[model samples]
Target: MRSRSWVRTVALGAVLLGAAAGQAQEGKMSQGVKAREQIEERYRWRLEDLYPTQEAWEADFKAVETDLQALGKCQGRLGKSAKGLGGCLDLQFSLTKRFYRLSTYAQQLNDQDGAAVQGQELNDRAGKLGTRLAAETAWVEPELLAVPARKMAALRKARALGPYGHFLDNILRRRAHVLGKDEERVVARAGDMANLPYTAYNVLSTLNLPFPEFTTRAGEKVRLNQAQYTRLRTSPDRDERRRVFQAFFAALRSFRESYAGLISGAVSRDHFYTQVRGYRGDLESALDATNVPTAIYTNMLEQVRAGRPLLWRYLRLRTQLLGLDKLTYSDLYPSIVPSVEMPIPFDQARGTILEALAALGPEVKAILEEAFASRWIDVYPNAGKRSGAYMSGSGYDVHPYILLNYVDSFDAMSTAAHELGHAVHSYLANKAQPFHYSGYPTFTAEVASTANENLLRLFLTARETDPKRRLFLLGEYLESWRTTVFRQALFAEFELKIHELAAAGKPLTADLLDATYLELLKEYYGVAEGVVEIDPLYAIEWAYIPHFYYNFYMFQYTTSFIASVAIAERIFSGDAAARDGYLAMLRAGGSLYPVELLKLGGVDMTTAAPYQVAFKSLEKTLAEVEQLAAKK
Candidate 1:
């Protein structure tokens, strides 16, 4: 109903989540997953910065409810005059800023401990409040659309309304799609139904679904939750990895119909917007929100599909390095260089990451230091903690927070740098821009986070003398490219196919979904060429990923990964202009469209230039991986 400045406040919370420890109380970090109470206070996030006490959070939440009535009073007044419009917007943003804080606090609290009833209740309360906010503010866009263009343009130029030009223009960009006030209200009310799929999905997947337990090679039994699945999939023991895949996917297979129903409903929700809004397709409708060209989406698909040869090359090399006759799906996650072990303690990893990111300049480095020291991160896996890591920057006034299940591995260190990139971006943008322009979209946001990851890898690569370690680093980078770039592209293709199928009036049955996914998996992994064998059971892997419910959100990972590779290469090469331009992009924030923001960061994602550079970088580093392996 409105820009994600407020609507998506909870988004930055748990996207790709990671951690380590120092204090006398932090020794538990080296152990297996513990309860949230077991984590040292120094390692936990200071959400109190947003609200020092529960009473304070309640005060703000109550204030928002009271202010929502006041905001509604100005509802019909938006089209009255410039002063009225600006004043109305002022109240709205203020309420949203406060709501964002409430939502973030509740979300992180629940995520840190899903079993806590109080945290779950707080999160549900925040959700209801968000729905109310959307329903009330839904009229703002339709009313603005009703305003005459001549007067609207003049209002945009008005000194009081100057800051709202971007926000207002974004609404006008979808002018044809904006419906009558009543129609807009209906769509706004449907927010709950639109949210049902993801909501039901999270409940079932996170809280309810019975994740199968497995015993490791050492006879240690473990419950394979999503986070554990990710961490264990990379096991060096082939038999163990196969069993992990079998047990985890078999659990989803039992609920295949339910997952299919949920995901199919997700696609149907997108289709509803497409048909109602007169969009070319769901892709058009989704991308149109951020002013991205559909060609950008299609172009990425074309480029990455054509670049499958590089993936095959890496796979062939991987097979040789692993001494396997041929690669299978399970073999993909283990280290190609088993001789190298990259583990750094949490405190030591902190220094290594800071050193890697120093090219970002002292100003950012200072903020990075503050982020670490100020407990801006929740840094260990505990009972009920959400899997994956993400950086939430929606707390415009309180600074950014990172959710990580740090396992004290090198990959976890890279994840810390990646999410910190997002934190720094939020810190810079929130500091530089106003409330309306502070929240950025995922497209450019991913670039910022990934850029930090690239810088870390490059910084490590340039310093390492051991060929095995260099190969390990190179292998990690290549794996990032595979997963973030090519693998996400394959996902994009599957997403589009499912959406198209749903639009064509076909049911997304579990059998159909499995067949479709397996087809793409086979093609993307070069299954037909005998490079890798894809098991049908792994097709349910889609059910494991949370992003499918995100509505065309996965493609940006590919696009951003490409952009960050180039951005990091330029900055690490000591290009002052490139470094400045890249940092400037983060500060620019949601003030610009996603693509234009990339241009500011010195990469044109619309063209093939960024793709070329990224592929070349991958190719170059991959060659070194081969040479290093050869040396062994």
Candidate 2:
């Protein structure tokens, strides 16, 4: 469900798109990361869960590729009749499932060890296979639409086509946008070039970028890689954090020209598609894939802007807790409860997450138990392993696999809960729906994950008798909001502005991008209002975020975080119907539109009430933390 760099369209929807958020693993980073074989088997994910061995994976890949090639034989014949169409549809989903399985396996293996020659080979093969499938099946929609109108209506109602009704209907609904077969192939063939910018960025950031070993103020010599910077940014020593910030951003700023060009190319790719597809712009084209209204994106920006006072309120609280004269950009990452430590070892994390998510019922508990037991997760950072955390639940027949650079901190534990939320959502969807409809859309993707996080926060805050730790837990919830809700909206707005800039024919340069980013940083952190000083040093922060390449993917984090807050509150209130409805929505999956799915889950994202509830909840929680801080 989550990945890096590329996304490919499939029978159901945009199946393998990546969203950039290094959502977790904010603990200490190993200066010298251990080799993969150095980790215990239990800590390593069993890709054997998907395939027993590389030979098995290769065989499956060959079979899937061959089947995909065979599907090309059915191209123009798709409009022939109900049975013929249904047969082709069945083969399409069937092969896509195997294709996805192949992709997940290769990709995860590659991430688990980026330097592995086998991983690189298999990953490259998978990418080529995806391109082949795209070029081969490019005629599907256009041909499906070419069916005679009366016959197509009958096909929609045909019992043989019942499972594919929604999938077929989605294709038909995109009639105005679906290109002719030849044009579609032309676009599909452009996949490799279209992916060049992000691919380069991902390669540079993940593999090739050189991070210097910097000495901390404590005289701790550490390699300031992505994970290390993430961990050290939380250092309580102000001057030390300032040094870390300077070093990290200075490193990123050094490569700003390349990052700027790569991002501009990304925008240009979006721009080209926008023009080719007859969309107004990139945002609409991205959101429209799943029938999501662009209004929700704009509304999220407006709502977060409206909630800026709360942000400043929280920032002030943070300053007070840290005993700061004033907050600055470097002050952002250190825990407000600097004295409290929540170091959760990986084993302890399993029990903690299981207990936190217990309200989701026995089924979810069973899944978590299995997830921990079955080695469904790769649980530690290793030399050459991918950074950050993500859960892939796209392989319908196989269980979800999570990749975590777990260093045994509270954030690492929270990452487990968050990713497991995605796992359970996928498990339930796969269990309840046919493969054709097993995948949920991007809109609802974060709801379950963030809900699990809320559950963890609430559970910890309630039982934590240690006042300091309780404060830590409560502050973490607020921080989660700041990062997910506030930070993401800022990203969404920045993404919008840049795309608009490109659309207006302004060429993006490193300086221009930095200036634009600096402007947003000032506004969002309330520099003008003195909430937090926006250092120009952090202007290159955009270069560090991988999500800038996510093609309007950042806004979903804010919306889903808001939705999860509402969902978690209902369940916490003992609203039995709400809990059941929410679980049902997980099970509903891609069977319904995302808005309808949220309604089924007892929160209508289309209405103002959910957003209202979320903001009110933030206020109440802020008041609680403020009261507790007052006692201090």
Candidate 3:
């Protein structure tokens, strides 16, 4: 993955490997996790792929610093000639390649053990170096845009600039928003202040605010961190899950005022940027960054809202299978059927994921095998290691690296499949496109990953002959759509509403937020139709989602999942053209805009057809699950 802008990273944690959203740290680890040194060498990633030694890393670090001066030499010369522009771009890519390699090494090292001071120092230095590189290359874009249109057209025709035509076109497309140097400098200065709200929220949630631990009804006492709260939600014990939910929300409620204030400030920051960029509103501003149209956003919300019947049906299915008189928000987590916990060992997961993704064809299968054999993955949890899973493809010149705390569950296996999708996508992109086009945008980023996840689920469902386990697997598949599409679309609606409210001069207080969220929850969950009940206290659930700080990011998960369903269905049905088209997409990377690329890959988000396909898939699974539930 290319480096995310720091402000967005601060908001979203920059999980670039594009695994399924809402992943939890679940499953059994023997005793507690181990220290990094205790893990066997084969299980850990070989950072040597990047640099053989710390000394080599330091050498490259200095080399990048030295090369920074050469970029400055191209600053005023970009518009002089096509060759001048091409030279500056080539130099920028060269310097950026080296800089990212150094940064990736330090970042992986630091993530391995965040408590280590030396690792922290190295990561910090890499961050500062990136800022320096940004400063040095800041003139290139504005200068290129300043060039006369006819001159840019002539430059585009130059053989030297052939590979960068799309790149230059993107800059020209944003010419209206690209400010003059002095004004750009002023906006850039304000960029430094934009992270304050997010920083404050991080500090409050992750560090300062106190969340007391709660003991489950089964006598296991658990601390109420974000991961623990997630793991406890699916507890077999209904009372236990309720205790977990109440306790977790109670903590969030206690800090309601503080959270309300912080989130309000974050919304204001978004509004500020939207206005400065001359966008009509926050949604337009946020979507414009990815060159997505406002229609795609509106269309997603509209489709999901219109698909409420499917959601209500799924909710009713859950109630019937769980043997509850009525469903409540607290009852939503337990598996619809008695879940067959498939404890897939690490080696088994590796093999299973390889087989599951074989539908993408032999080339993808080969890439997955390499990912396993080449030590491209760091595959277990250790003391002070980062929580959750992600793929760091920042090593553009090298193979992608994946970080996994692989707990032995079916979900863990699915995570493996999802992240390997990202890894292989990066592998193909980096191999097929130049360095500049190698990194894909977030709009299409989750397509390959989520498609892999769907493929894995379909593979598992096909093989499970036992009726009960098949039902469980089917429910698992439906639950994925519930969370990824239906639920995230709901989140997208809430985010849009809140942003609109703030932009319209409505003060966002805890009460207002809670009421708005509660109303939406009831509407989507069909509380009025008696599909589920929303407890008033659960209205504060929005306060718990860290992704709200991510500024209109949750919708892509829905859009991408919808597109992937269409793509995966075609490939799984043995369509040769679809398979080739999907492969072409993975290889295209950022060479095309996300919407265009998805269209080429057989799913077009601009229309409602793909969303209808997704809903049909959900409806089909729900019908099967409903029939299976009758047998129970």
Candidate 4:
């Protein structure tokens, strides 16, 4: 559920609105109250970790852009010899690494406080530079494909290219999909145009749109931005939760048509790429780069559908525990055991996460320690800082940067652990693999993060003796299972159905999307059986999700969470092999396909084994919680 920037050096096209860290209930700080200088040095991330100063960054920025000419000179000569190809690749990787450093620095500055105009300009410049780099280096893949398969094999034996054989082999494997020089150029040129919908969606969501303020039952006026809406939805006050839910969806419903149009454009863009690449559909088109089979996606949806009874059981248990006649959409979030949130300050959350993560081994523990001690995190919420938690791994040589508006709650601790998982993964990957292979695909990206959260749960649940407190922690874990696995699977289903309709030449109108989503919601929540009631207005929930524009990305969250459950179980059982295997998978990075690397880590996601394992784990936790509740 954590927002992530991944390996893409460019700024995110869509700024997703919700927080993985628990959201704040009000705007505690007035607008423009805190300047970047006003923050304590210890709490601020050391951007100097990447570049010592703005002057240093500017020098390198100019140098990297000029280095593109050096790259341009080697273009036509790549096929002259194996050594020539290796030299070109060496230069290419070097430039990209430097570019990643530069781009990530600008991104970190901009994210520190999103209001700084200078930061925004630098971020925009970095993005344009990235687009230019993509165009400049577009010839590499096509030209490499033009070489005979036999030549590539022979080239692998050459000492210079031997290190890159894995990368070269991947290119040759996708030979059929690689377009010719002119067509590749055309596709590359159209990249910016194809991204318009995403750009527009980000602007509309983060800046231009007006979110209404709502008054709570306490007679307090609160503005319902994305963060406030998320926080209030889980308020102990049922009336407040109801008000927040209605107001939030009402605001979204007003812009339903706009969202539909933007999302339709995104779907069409996917469809265009699918046809251009000769893939069967949009799903295959998206998965092709990672070399994952379409069956994995379909099987995940089927398995999650099969697990619906358990999902329903959990919901019924929640309703019964709350003593409600029937569970409504608004009632889904309040804690099962208590009416108040357990406050956890940032310093305490930090110690708890580090201790929980100790099971991963000492090497990882050291990385987390450095991250905290070295100001690698930009902690606390500020006047104009970006909301939510995300790890920026674009700093290749330097350490990863984590941005979080941490509130003192257990969820915030989980968010910290989740992001630190990413940091540790990147640190290990960069250390073990070369720059070219350091970045992981989105398919396996969430494994380490969610696995960390699993470890935290295992640590916390075992140590706590109070029955109600243990039940609360366990219920939160179950909610993670629901949201990360079941709920995301539902989202994956919606994405698939909508894409299918779009591919079949059906119009993606607001009514059509609303009805399709509402049906899926009913099926998943089992409204007919009285497990939960869905308000008609809640059908517009699809409009609030920014992930839909991400092009078949939500399914990976389900898959990764399931895989991590299996991985965390083995590691938590004190299995040395499992520990090493998980670390090795993180270190392997993009050198291997995601599925292959995961298989090496002892979770073969292509089969039903891991999915079944995950369900069993979920069932075990449910039984433990049920057993504890029975004692009362």
Candidate 5:
């Protein structure tokens, strides 16, 4: 994957260009042409929602600094008495809430205008404040660990401290591994520097490196950057797709040593942190930090491996439908049933999404409608707008913001539905839970979003009566499974092997990484049907994925898709019981572990039932596509 530095550099470049455009437009305001509204005016996100003014933000910033300083006073008192501990907890929570508000405002401002000097300043200031806060609160856990388990249980039962029972218990449960104050400070300080490797990689990938040019079908040359690369990847023409793959990776390969250094640095950083914190391995350490079981990660890989035959079968179907003698990696993208492009405008997309979600009833639909009606979304791609899409929700004190470089297309429409699922999840959690528990863990986060996408897919499939369009919808469904489940699982497998190798004191040089990745690509795509040819250069392809920086995070995409398919199936089958259970799961938030929460929603990740069911859906869709293609 590109280093974080490279990502930031790319982000900074986009911001700079965006700022220049904004300034130029401001200068031309006097011309007869209408002036574009400031970002604030164009959107309903209302930065005021986070902080009414710059002055208010500054006031809170100073207040948090002062409050954080006072937290030091409670350092040794956590074990003193129930009252002392309770007081300390209250202070910590209050300080966190205040800091969150300030940080949210700063971050939202920066995200909206990455090039703005003031926004950048606020972001940096908030980051520094956060580091100071972490240092001050570093003592809380260690101090809590000082208390005996029996005494902690007694304090938990005390009426005065009843409200914070969960908070106290959670901290105490991890007491065995909790480090001392000095150690914690060192770990905290190392974090800022630890991020440097990724930052460096990002800078090189996004700004420093020169992208190669590709010739389109029209003989027109296009310089391939991140945005254009994405478009080319999805091009309908197979040759165009092949050209993109070759050119893009060729550029990346030119800087092989630089990419290798960044990745090595990141691996080293992870190992350092693991050793300092007394972890068995980096993989274990990463999973432990997120409170997820290692078995969940391993189980996902095992299940995906077992399901490879089904994937092969699906690929064979695609080969037949596309009337190709042999399928290559490039063939996996373009539409198989291309009757019409069917580009849905943003407004229509919003309406379609709301209407599809009507199954969740009026209340759910109302919230979604509000998201569309409110200026919460920054729609359309303008010069310098960030590439891709994300739904960002800092906390309940602020509303969610959905950013899209939307180009009216079917895929873009599905992306809108997917992101809103995240927004709704945040909305529900924030509304129901306290600030402490408002955020769900990353494991369960993708469930709601994927479920929304599945629901929208079902809606679109049902509404389309034409055979070709219906086939298109089904083709999309099959592709989603392929991409989200199979593709991500492949990534998960590669990530695990690399980390394991690193932790075992083995070399993870670019050559070794590339070989391992290419092997997996061959295993996943090199089935008996000969649909896709997994290229050798694609091995180093793993270096470009950002998710590796996230540490075993991509697997959830596969797991969540399977889980969502199960839930969506139940809802579509008119199972009122299933629908209710799924809704309750959403509302349950972080109160339950992901596995348990998924069980409540009628899918058990511990078992292979969900995977089998989801794969069956893939098989069924492929069969339908084959039938349609045969008819023509």
Candidate 6:
């Protein structure tokens, strides 16, 4: 039931359109009026939010092209001295800023249809130019590695390149894995081709797949693709939800062999890169790139396993609330308490999110206001709009841009809050840290956003007056635990098994993959007493998830949920010190390792405490839901 990548593409385009087209309803305005209007007038988003005019963007783009070409002059000189290395880094940072501005403008322009033709051409050119610029300066890493460790250490102290010390240290740490100039050049040139398999799969899935049409419960015909699947999963009628799932899985089942090839190519790609880099294993290689320990990844899986009993307990509660003899995979998406539909308007949702986040202090609130007032948000869904939501942040020089599909529903509102949490995290980090440390790792990135969701859930639960509404809110919280934590853990486990099979030199055919996934599904769902049927075809479910292409990435969702729950609890418990500590973690960015950064937020991911706390919270919510059902 999770949102697909293509939806994100649509949602992103919609955000761009919303910014350019303003708030006119579909068919209400003329094409010329929509096209000619600046991003701010027709939509809630301010395209002018980043740049006042297309002419201004051209000027910035030209400036960046000139500066990027100048970076070639700094090659081979980085190892001369600490000052030289610092100068090169400073220039790189400047070039990066210009590139970010140009790229953001081009993307915004392309998002709007009026700007689509020229905008897309410009974007492609800028991308190619940026890659060329990056290739020119790729020699810096090799040159830095050539410098003796002792000499580099001395330079760090003598030259007082304080902000860049961590940056240099990271490069030195990877010196053993760093390739020679010729090898590095070969790898850099292979970048575009290296991603061919993933690119091919994306094109086929997004553009070529012939999604089937299905009849909804309302008797309306709908084409069942990724986006329609999202809509169908949330259908009020259970039969409609079931039909959609069956049809969708059937489509995937039919293409099992093709999907297997795509998945195999992705897994092989990971193994290839890891071996080339001399990593002991693929998981280690993936985690090492972000400086996150492998223990954290394994710990997440262990914790989720330990909490299986709690998941089973919740499943029983779900069966009871839905008045079903058995709970199947199809039953999972519908609300156990069907009466609780809390539709919050976009404006009211904004107010609610701000009120919930009040514990983060006034300064945090100001940034949220800026998001609204400065037109940083592109709100609403339109034809050809990208699906789903995301927060895109570059650095301090360029503010964050948020993309959303607001349908005046609580779920959409929740998405807005989630992405804004990312924006706020980026804003604080960029403001507090230097350019070198402005971005955080993906492992830590989800913590801020998930924590915001937790806080918002708590605030809404506390304020609800009606019993049904309270149950509905509680159901939403429980659903988050089920999906983000339990379901992702299921994914992580399946991925681990697949990789182990590959590591053992076993071939992963379609049949083998199906068997492996079905077995995991049975274990996770606890299908004793003939309660639920584990469909054999559902094994192809693995083929649909794009995150599997990202090595060892799914485990972060489970770990992040655990970390966020603990932090949100502390902040809501009136602990001002805890709130400050959490804020500090957001500001630390990539200045420290993910585990170390999390420690400052009072959650020691190295320990079992966070996982235990998150499971306990799940148990408590289930208990409350059960009690409410008993009264009913």
TM-score list, all predictions: 0.83, 0.82, 0.90, 0.86, 0.83, 0.87
Candidate 6 lDDT tens digits, 1-632:
01222243233223333321112112222222323334444345666756788788788877877777777877777767778778888998778776776777676555544234787887787788778777877677777888887888787885647778788777788877777778877767766566666666666666677788998877889889866887688676667778888898888787788888877887887887777778888888878877888888788888887887777888888888878877778887776776656678787998999999988889999999888877788776544444456687773576788877677887787788889889999999988898779888766787888788889988888788789889888987787777878888898888888887887898889888898888888888887635466667666787677666556767877888899999998898789998999999999988987888999988998789988777778888888888998999
Colliding pairs, model 2: none
Clashes of each: 8, 0, 1, 0, 18, 15
| Runs in model 5 lying further than 4 Å from the true structure | 1-43, 46-70, 105-132, 148-150, 180-193, 207-213, 224-228, 235-237, 251-265, 370-389, 395-409, 503-505, 509-511
Q: In candidate 5, what are the lDDT values of residues 193-301, reduced to their tens digit?
A: 8767766776787788799877889788988986688777878777789989899988999888778778878878888877887888777777776567777778888
Q: Model 3: per-residue lDDT, tens digit, 387-438?
A: 6677878899889999888889887777778788889889999999999999
lDDT of 4 at 91: 94
RMSD of each: 6.0, 5.2, 4.1, 4.5, 5.5, 4.8
Order the numbered candidates by lDDT, best leading.
1, 4, 3, 2, 6, 5
Cα lDDT, all candidates: 0.84, 0.82, 0.82, 0.83, 0.74, 0.76
Model 1 misplaced regions, further than 4 Å:
1-69, 99-136, 185-264, 339-343, 372-392, 401-408, 502-515, 535-546
Tell me the lDDT of model 1 at 625: 82
* Candidate 6: RMSD to truth: 4.8
Q: Rank the candidates by TM-score, best first.
A: 3, 6, 4, 5, 1, 2
lDDT of 1 by residue, 1-632 (tens): 00011111123323321110001111223235787888899889988898899899899899899989998688778877899999999998998888999999998888788878988999999999999998889778778889988878877887988888888878888888877778877887887788788778878887788988789888988999876887788898888999999999999889999999999999989999998889989999998988999889999999898889999999999899888897899999887876566677788889999999899889989999999899999988887877667788989998999988887788788778878988999999999999889988778877887788889989999999987788878877777777777878988999999998888888999999999999999999999899999888999988877678777877877887789999999888888899999989999999998888999999987788888888888889878888877777
After superposing candidate 6, which stretches have Cα over 4 Å from the reference?
A: 1-55, 112-125, 182-193, 203-224, 227-230, 233-247, 339-341, 380-388, 529-531
Poorly placed runs, candidate 4 (over 4 Å): 1-49, 52-66, 109-132, 148-150, 181-193, 196-215, 219-232, 235-262, 339-347, 380-387, 404-407, 505-511, 628-632
**Candidate 2 Cα lDDT to native:** 0.82
Best TM-score among the predictions, by candidate number: 3
Minimum summed lDDT over a 10-residue window in model 6 is located at 20-29
Two-way lDDT contest, 1 vs 3, winner? 1
